[model samples]
Structure formats: structure tokens, C-alpha cells
Target: MTPTLNGPPAPPADTRCDRIDRLRAALNRALRGKPGVVEYVLAGLLARGHLLLEDLPGLGKTTLAKAVAAAVGGTFARVQCTPDLLPGDITGFSVFNQKTREFEFQPGPVFAEVLLADEVNRTTPRTQSALLEAMAERQATVDNVRHPLAPTFFVIATQNPVEHHGTYPLPEAQLDRFALKLSVGYPDRADELDLLAGAIGDVSDARAGAPVLAPGDLADLQGRVARVAVQPNVRAYLVDLGRATRAHAGVTLGLSPRGLLIWQRVAQAWAFLKGRPFVTPDDVQEVARPVLGVRLGLAPDAARFVLDQILAGVPVPV
Candidate 1:
């Protein structure tokens, strides 16, 4: 359950959305020319789901993650995952304390409000599995004891798609945990030139002047996202779409029941971002690609085509 904020009550719903819009603008500034990427990332964040960024190197993946952490005014940590990294390193381990005459639990980077797992696929499977519980349960079990993570423990993991030389591909179960996976493709010529200018100059902090929403307030916004109504007809449309994926010839494995819930949450967030109180079919279609494409097993190009077919085949409920 999402913990309630103890301070003054959260601002009204409109105020909260306004605050979110400010953060979105800041992210757009930080990641120039990728408004769609920024929107998807924001949706994942509001849905309280972990994100997987699969893109080439130096595409501002880390920069986007940092900008999010900064905009939210949350603590951020980046783990440069490697083959030798141990589960203990990500989740931390108990150390013998001579003064206390007992083992003392030392927390790891996973305790932060926002964690960036860079080149996550490069790490061993064992180390990769360390995040499963944390991502799913918002808590980590170490030394056979349960340790609760922060209420807003969001993860932004990045992996390189161009390289397969030394990487452990994430299993389906692990991939399912990510709410959405996206690529920050090369910018357009105009955006590229503007980026070059920013490169030569001292780029200002993206969130420096922006109004920073308190952590608790952001949590309240997420709660509001959860409450975003999904009309019955739209809900049925989601189920039909899921069934279509299962029947697709190219798909060896289809989205699971859990995937449907994640899809709804993401759609709800999208609707909320669009200033809507209820989810619409358009919202679902807008988010279908990133939400479903990540979980499909087809080739990257094929996945896009299949998604388009799935959407086109499904009757849009009025």
C-alpha cells in the first residue's frame, strides 16, 4: 500500500498535474527533441513501475534519469553493472560490527529514491535477479530479514541494443517487471544542431529553476494516477488486445495477466498526463507500442509491425 503523506495535505488534483507538467518540461529540456520518450518515461514513473531503457550509448539515458531524480528532488544512485557484480553488492550485506558485537546491516545503492542500472544486461544473471523483489515488492529481503525501501523507489535501467558480445539477456519474467521499454533514437537535424550548441556551452541544470514537487506530494500524484477511472468498455478493449497478441502467429509467448494490469496503469498515467479523469481508447493506443513491444519476442522490426497489426485489428470501442 502507498503510505499516506504526514505533512500538510497534498495540493488539489489540478495543482498536482500542473506540478507534473513542470517536471515534464524540465525532462524535455534535458533530453532535447524526444518528447515521446519523455512522456513514456513520465508515464512509467506515475504508474509506479520500473523502466528499461534499451538504446545505444550516449543517447542521454543517464542524463534523462538524472534529470528525473533532480526534478522530483529525490536521491539518485547509478550502478555500473558488470559481470563480476554480486547480488550482495546491489542489495548490500551485513557486516560484523565489533563495537556492537553483532552484524550490522549496511544498505546498498538500491535504497535510493531513483536507481539507474547502467548496462544492466552486462551483469550476471544472479546479480540481475537481485532487483526482482525490490522492483516488485518495494522491499528487499537480506539476511532473511525484510527491509522496506523508500515509498518511491523507482528504477531506470539502460542496456545497449547494438552489442550482444558479452551480455546476459533478461529472461521473460524479468522483462515483464519493466512497465515500459523505449529507445532514445537519434535526434532530428534541428535538434542535433541545438544539442551541439548546448554541448559547447555550459548547459544549465535542467531542474535548477523548476518548481520541485516534494517526494510525498509526488506519491500523492501516483495515488491519483491509480484512481484514474478506466471505463468498462476501455477495460474490455484492453483484454481483447491481450488476447489478440496470444493468437498472433509471430508471438511465441504472449503477455501475462500481470502485463494487463501494468498496461492499465500505464494507460491511466497517460490519461492523467493528458488532463483526463478517465482512460480512453486513444490513451491505450498512444501507449500500446512501448508497453507491448518490450514484452514481445519478435525481432525489433517485426515487433513494431505486429503491434501495428494488433492495434489495427482491434475495433476501437466508442
Candidate 2:
């Protein structure tokens, strides 16, 4: 049996769908010609999971992250990660107050509702680990004291794929925390033309429009997403895919228990976005690539081939 969510009942399904449509439009405007990418981003958001965008520079990765922060309507904070950045810089540190003569905890970017860690791979491993606890628990501990972050805390991190000399690749543990890893490729010619046409306008107007969902509205939608029903056969199919990943000779590391759970939740969010209350085999297959890509620890090309093989081996529930 599915556990009942604790939040207030969600708005009517039609109302929720309309709100999602508005949010989608806001994101689409922010990143033109990538509606498919935007859809997965929404699924990750509604799944209450973080996002990792790995792509070449100047491909609208940062732009998309900023748009998400703006559309979500929260205290947005950005960190341009570097090698010298310390863990405390991202998670916060303690300072002795001159007046009060007591140590005061200074909250860092992790406290924000929307955090964008640009070029995350540019940071050292120690600094990269700072986000581990925060992303997993939605809380930060400083001076052994835990500070609760906003219920809607969301992270959108970007990293360059071509640069390797000065960058530290994200460990499997860190990659596993993200719901999906996406690449925002170059825009099509028509979209590029449209982009150039819009570029002539005032750049300041490019930001996302008014907040689509009010504060707490996103959390409600996420709660509703968690309650989307999953049948026994679909659950079994998910397990089968996971096992196949483990058995695949090409894959060095397979999906962990946590990854499997995240896959189910993301599929549930996908179903909710499609205006359905129950998860289907199609929904599971649709989100398979992104959900599995981040944790598979293989190059994009090799991973694609291996993923295809694994999917082919697993029988889809009827």
C-alpha cells in the first residue's frame, strides 16, 4: 500500500496540470528549442531530486539553471566553484561574534531555495563533498549543529564535459544524488534564428516571467507525485532492469538501491506530468536513459549501447 502524503490535499488535477503548463512555458522561454530537455527537468523537479547538467560551455546550461531558479520563485544563490573553494564556503562556517562573544553560524549558499553550482567539477573533491549531505538530507550541519534548509531546496549543478585538465570528475556517490543528468545540445537552425531575433531585444527581459507556482505550491505538487500509484508488474520491471544493469559486463557499477528508488519516483513524476494517476511501463521506459545515465559510470557512447542491450533483455510488463 502506498503511504498517504502528509501535506494538504493537492489542488484539482486540472488546476495542477495548468500550473505545470505555465511552469513549462516559463522554462521553455528561458531555454529555447529544448522542450524535451525541459520536460525531464520538470520531472526531476517534481520528483524532489537535484539535477546535474553536463555539456559543453555556452550551451545554455547556466541559463536553464537560472531560469529554473527564477520560475521556482525562491531565494536563489549561485556559486561559481573553483579549486580553492573550501567546504565551509559552500556549507557555511562559524565565526566568533565580537559583540556577543559567541560563535555565530553564517549560512552559505546551501541555505537558499535554489542553488546553482556552476562548473562544479572545477572544485576539489573536499569542496565537492560539501554538497553531499545537503543534497541528501536538505539540511546542513555546522559546528555540529544542524540547520534546516527550505522544504523546496533544489540544486542545479553544471559541469563541462570536454575540459579535464583542471576539473575533478564527480564521484559516483555525488552523481547518484541527482535524479537526471542532461546535456543541452546546440539549438536547431530555426530555433537559432529565433534566438538571434530575440537577442536584439533588451537582454534584461530574457529572464523568466512571474513565478508560475506560489511558494509551497511546488512542494504540494511533489507530494502529489509521490502518491501516484505503481502496480506490481511495473515495480517488477524496474527491479528487472536494475538486475540487468548489475549483470551487464559492460557496466562497471550498476544501479544501487537508492538509484532504483529514484528511478521509480522519477517515473511517478513522469506519469503525473502526463495527467495520469498511475505509473505505466511506457513511463518507466521513457525516463530510463537520464535516470540511469548519471550513475552508470560509463562514457556516454558506451553507456548508451549498454543501456540499449539491458533494456532489450528486460521484458516490459504488459
Candidate 3:
């Protein structure tokens, strides 16, 4: 086929798109030495899905959420889960108004654009349920009145792995709600040294950089991500891969339909971040470890083994 003059060539297969480049720079300051993770996080973000970060403390989980919120130029609220934390603390409460002669609903931390659900499993099941409806529907029905959240209501949830005392485990239902459960595993030695050097001087000036995106940009990104293309055979592969997980011998529980749908969305985000407009089997495979592995009920060590096996053998419908 003859090419037309004055037309730009298609982008390289492996270029981080401009928006993703901006996204990477935005979080690199706070999230040091986790470029791979930053990419997947963007995948989750563009997919319009919640994130569950499971790792040891002090690895920038809280900071990651804050940086993402700042990067997107959205409101940020932190919810510290405690044993005594109640559902009302999250979904807000209706207070009586004497002057107006009516009860007015006041929002809680959940009303923000990006909410950091810190130490989520520490709270009781009853209280955790407060997020179920909001995370799933992006709206909370409070006092029988449905309150719509901001269009980009992203939840970055975190939990401590070593510290489990007095912590309630997140049931499968809620765990399944998360699009991807990622861990910022330990940083490399050179990166750790870079961290130490980066902290040698005060850096408040770095935090003051103007946001690369407006609040509306994030919403636009979400819509654009939705417009990304996906093929039918790839869709079938996603379904088959998810079905394999449920049917695995070592696997205790498999990912549900919701999980497959969330994976599909995350795959789109992955492609977008990689500067592509179409989903590939590699996108699904790259995300399957984090997006699907967490849902598998294998023991921690066994989980890794099983994931490896799953990845090694899956016939990616090329």
C-alpha cells in the first residue's frame, strides 16, 4: 500500500505515550524505584477500578495514593481504619437541622475524588461493607438518599501483611471488588541509595510542581481508555484464562465474572500506558499476576508457584 504524504507515521510499538509519560513523572517523586509498579497502577487507574496494595509498611503505599491524587488534581481524603471505626465514619451521617427543620446529610472521607483506605483489613466486616456499594456503583445510598460521588472516584486501599493482630481479613466479595492487588516489593539497592541521596536535602520545591492533569483530565483519560480497542479472540482468551484459575487444582477459589471484566479493563489501561490503542495477550499476561493472582487462595509461596505455572503454560490465542 502506498502511504500518503504529510501523514505522520504510527507510533512505535513500545513507547510510553505522552499522558503516561506525564503520569510516570508525577508519581516518580513519591514512588521511587518502582517503574513496573507505576505502569500497573496506571493500568488500574485508567481502568476506573480500585487498587488494593498489600505489602509491608514504609514502602510508600500511603504516599503512592497521595501522589496519584495530586497528579490527577483531585480531592484526597484518608480513612484510617481502626477496630472501632464504624460504617457511619465512612459513608457519612445525617445530622438533624433545627433551623431548616430537616436532616441534612454530611459526607465523610468517602465523598472525595481519591480516597486512601489505609489499613483496610483492620476495620470490622460491618464497617468495611460501607465501601462495597460505593466502590461497586460509585454512589452511596445514605439515609435512603443516593449520593453520587465524583466521576473519578478512585479508591487506593492498603493493608499490612506482617501485622495481622486485631485485623479482620477482607472477605472474597470485597477482595474481588479490587481491579488489581499490587505490592511495591522492596526497592533495589541502587534505588535505595538513590532514595537516601534524594533525601539528603529538603525537597518541598519538588512537591510544588503544577499538576500535569486537571481533575477533568482524569475523567477524560478514563473515557479515552474506554475507547481503546479490544479484539474478540483476546476477549475469549481472558475468559478462558479466568476460567482456568477457578478450575486449577491448587486454586481454592477462582476469579468471578466481575474479575474477568475488571481484568479486561485493566488490560486496556495497560495498552494505553504502553502507547498502544489495542489490547494484546501480553497485556493480559502482564497484569494477570497482580490482577488475578491475588484472588487465588493459594498459600503465599504456593501462590507464586501457581502463578508461574499458569503463565508458563497458558496458550495465548495468538
Candidate 4:
């Protein structure tokens, strides 16, 4: 059963589909050659989950984050992380106001609907931990007082995987908060040429389409996604696959129970994006790389091998 909200009524199915198509087309125009990547990112967004982008610099990661924020018409904020950053900087602190004779709570970048933490690895562990509460609880604690963030708080963090100097690796606990980890690699030759040709213009083309779904609509859609059907067999398959990861010799840490739940939600979101009410094994497989890659922590080559083995070993429900 979908939870009913007192807010505005949800648009009809056809209307929603039309809006999604328009949004997708707009993103395609902006990204030029990354249809698959666009779909993956959309899945995470619809799932109401955080994302981590581990790629080299100048790969359009920041651009993708900004474009997503624009597409949703949400408040966008960015934090350029550095080793010297403090937790209070990301989560604003209270300052004493002389006129009011009290302290005023100041909201930080984490208060926005969409927050882009660029080069998250560049920050110290303490500063990185500042996102833990906000990412998990959708609230921030400043001076022991809680501040609620936007209803649709989504984080898109990017870090350079190849860079080790001046970088602090994200803790396992922090990494687990991200539902998916992705990479926006370089564009192909033709796409690169096209980008160069249009280099003189602004990124406004990405934000061309008006918001198709508002915060209320997103909340309702997420509720509907939660109701997406998964067969008993498929559920069993997920459990079995999770167990396999735990039993794998190469993996030091396996997917936790929370991780499993997040994996299922992402699959459900992917199905919803495809206009399906039921999830399929293919849906799970499609999102496996990003979901599993972040948690597995295997070498790139080894992670691919392990993921392939797990997927192959699991029996797909008929």
C-alpha cells in the first residue's frame, strides 16, 4: 500500500512517464553520450539514496551533480573539501547574537536538497564524518540542537580514485552510506568533438527542462517504489547472493543487512524507472556494479571477477 500524503495529488502514470521522458531527453542533450550513466544516476536519485562518484578529475562529475540538482529544481550547495576543513564548516554552528541575546542556528551546505561534496577524499576523516548523521538521519546536530534538512536531501560526492596524496580514504562506515558508487569516465571521440564544438555555451542546456517532479511528487513516488513487488524467489536469490559475497575469499567485508536493503531499493527504483511494477533479476544485475563496488572494496579487476562470479552463481527466478 502506498502511503498517502496530504500534499498535492500525484500526476497520472502517463503524465509521470511524459515528464520522465522530457527530463531524460534534456539530460541526454546535456551529457551528449552517456545514456547508461544517466539512467544509473536517475535510479539512485529515485531510490532516495546517496551516491559516490570515484573517478579522475575533469570527467564531468561536478557537471553531472549540478545538472541533477537543476533537473530536480532543488536547492543546490557544494563543498570543496580540503584537509583543513572542519565538521562545523559543513554543518553550520550556532553563533551568539548580541541583538537577540541568544545564539542563532546557521544552516550549512548540508541543508540543501542537493549537496555536491567535491573530492570528498581530500577532507580529513573528522570532516568527512560530518555527513554521517545528515546522510542517515536527514538531520544535523549543532550545539546539541537538531536541525531538519530538506525532505529530499540527496548527496552526490565525488573523489579522485587515482590520487593518493593529500587524500584521506573514506571509512567503511562512510562508504556504506552511499547506495551506489560510480565513475563518469571520459567521453568518446565523437562526443568529445561535439562538446568542444559547443564549448562556448553555458551548461544551461542541462537545466533547460523545467522540473518534472517536485519534492512532494518525489516523496510519493518513493513510497510507490517501496511498494514495488519482488517475488519470493527473487528475495531468496538476493539473500543467496549476499551470502556468497560474505563467503567469498577475496572480500574482507561483505554487504551488511542495511546494504542488502539498499540494494533491493535501488533495484526497485530501476524497475520503476522502466515503468514496471515488479522487479527482475536483470534489474538487479543492471545496478549491481555501482551498488556492490562501493561495499566490496576489491581491486578493480578483482571486483569485476567477483561480481561476475556471484551473478553467475545465483539462479535467476523464473
* Backbone clash count for every predicted candidate, in the order shown: 0, 0, 0, 0
TM-score versus the correct structure, for each prediction: 0.92, 0.94, 0.91, 0.92
Candidate 1 per-residue lDDT over residues 105-160, each given as its tens digit: 99999999999999999999999999999999999999999999998889999999
Backbone clash pairs for candidate 3 read: none
lDDT of 4 by residue, 63-155 (tens): 777777777778789999998989999999888999999999888999989899999999999999999999999999998889999877999
How would you encode candidate 2's per-residue C-alpha lDDT over 183-268 as one tens digit per residue?
99999999999888877867574455678788887898888888888878889999999999999999989999999999999999
After superposition on all C-alphas, the RMSD of every candidate to the true structure, in Å, is 4.6, 2.9, 4.2, 3.9
Query: What's the CA error at residue 297 for candidate 3, in Å?
Result: 2.2
List of clashing residue pairs for candidate 1: none
What's the TM for model 3?
0.91
lDDT score of residue 249 within candidate 4: 84
Error in Å for residue 246 of model 2: 0.3
Q: Stretches of candidate 1 above 4 Å error?
A: 1-16, 201-211
The top-ranked prediction according to TM-score is 2
The per-residue C-alpha lDDT of model 2 at residue 5 equals 42
lDDT of each: 0.87, 0.89, 0.83, 0.83
TM-score of 2: 0.94
| lDDT computed for candidate 3 | 0.83
Candidates arranged by lDDT, highest first: 2, 1, 4, 3
